[model samples]
Target: MRLLYSIVMLVLTFSASADISGRVVRVLDGDTVEILQASRERTRIRLAGIDAPEKNQPFGQRSRQFLTRLVAQRHVRISGDERDRYGRILGTVWLDGEDINAVMVRNGLAWAYRYRGKATEPQYAEPEAGARAVKSGLWADPAPVEPGLWRKMQKTPE
Candidate 1:
């Protein structure tokens, strides 16, 4: 049974990890965008491996603006597998061969995504560290809040 489950998981991973190329039609936020494919289909992509500040959070607009400057109306390639609960494709966005997801973290505009308090993408650790050391972007805040924690705080009754 374990072997069968492993095989199924492998198949699902491969099927989901398709490469997509399209023009970035909109920058929804620091970590999300709308891509217009050649087929004229619009797909919402949630950048993999990083979580940017929420729209109302400090430096959130700047994060979005920076991402816009990087990829807005530009052609990009997305490589990833899986979708979020909201149906946004989870992918690494590449523009001019640069990893936009890593850029966001390196610039301190976003945090390396974590699941259960563990970093999901180890490669981002060094960049995030460097950004912190330099006090870049949101890191300049004396006490920057992680987006996840901020969300939970928002839901708690005042």
Candidate 2:
């Protein structure tokens, strides 16, 4: 039974790791984009390992604009892992070998979003630390709230 369980897990993992390539039709925000696939199907993708400000949050527009400039109408390679709760593919976006997720964190346009009790990407930490140390982009704010916390605060009646 243990062997069977391990085999099942391996199969599931492999099945979820899809290699998708497409042109970015839209930059929904700093950490989300719409890709038009080679098959001519469009899919929304949420960038993995990072979260940018919500549209209504501070620096949100800047984050979106920055992402647009980086990827809009550009062909990208997506190393997808899973579908998010919202049905958006969760993946690392690459453009000419550049990891867009890491770039966002390095530029301080997005946070390295690692949930407690979840596996964290070691590659994400250094860029975030460097950005924070230098007070770049959104980090320039003395008290920048994370996008998750900012969303919670918005939901809680002021």
Candidate 3:
């Protein structure tokens, strides 16, 4: 089961890379964000390092609110590792030279996903470490639901 999970994760990591700079027009869930580039080029950006709760799951809206507070309708530069299954460009979002992915990790609002690739950007493992140590945001709660687990739970839809 672990091997299968790894293989599936690996497949998701191997993809194409594209560089684009644009404005963050919308925040889709937590990990996924949308950017509106010039010439009306709209690209969906998946946060490279961190994963947040799904919209319908617990803490979902809070995650979106956090993202909105951090970057709402602002200009951000996107550096891609690759596009994911949903056709969203997976990359690090930089706002004024600061990496939003790293920031999310530092805030305890996300987890450092272990997926690896060059198409994968530098999601330094330390951000999450610091966040966990300080107990920021959801981490302050006795227990916080992992985005992956939330995704799985939502799949069966009780």
Candidate 4:
């Protein structure tokens, strides 16, 4: 059993390290999106720059819908960065010359995520501030929970 577990761990570790790309076919929410890459391969990408409230939260759907409006199933360019503990790609998605990550923060859909990675570019910081100032997304709440955390909470058994 232990040997089988080791093999599974190795496979999962290698799988997580493999880099691939696909067109963002769907935006699941503020932090999760579905991609249809070459050969009909499908993947879910978490935008690296920002994090938004969970779908169950007040502005969760709004943030997700906002992302859809910004860019939905667009032909995008994806590259891997440092993987978070969740093994989600910390990649920058681009549609034309615009950075989708930056756009999310600017439009009040997400908050700049600077925890796992280093501080983002100053220009990147601008959008988050603007969005927060306008009370967009969770910024409007007196105390809003992050979408990732909300997901964890929902899964916990009473």
Who wins the TM-score comparison?
1
After superposing candidate 1, which stretches have Cα over 4 Å from the reference? 1-15, 156-158
Span of 10 residues, lowest total lDDT, candidate 4? 114-123
lDDT of 4: 0.75
Residue-level lDDT tens digits of model 4 in 63-154 = 88988886686777765556667766677777787878888778777777665544454566778778777887677787766655677878
Q: Is candidate 2 or candidate 3 better by lDDT?
A: 2
lDDT of 4 at 78: 66
Model 2 off-target regions past 4 Å?
1-15, 117-119, 156-158
Per-model RMSD to reference: 3.8, 3.6, 9.4, 7.2
Q: If both were scored by lDDT, which would come out higher, candidate 2 or candidate 4?
A: 2
Best candidate, lDDT: 1
Q: Rank the candidates by TM-score, best first.
A: 1, 2, 3, 4
Residue-level lDDT tens digits of model 3 in 39-150 = 7888888887677767776667887889888888899998876668988888888999998888877777777776542212344567776787888866787787777676
- Cα error, residue 63 of model 2, in Å, equals 0.7
- Model 3 off-target regions past 4 Å? 1-18, 115-123
Candidate 1 TM-score to native: 0.89
Better-scoring candidate (TM-score), 2 or 4: 2
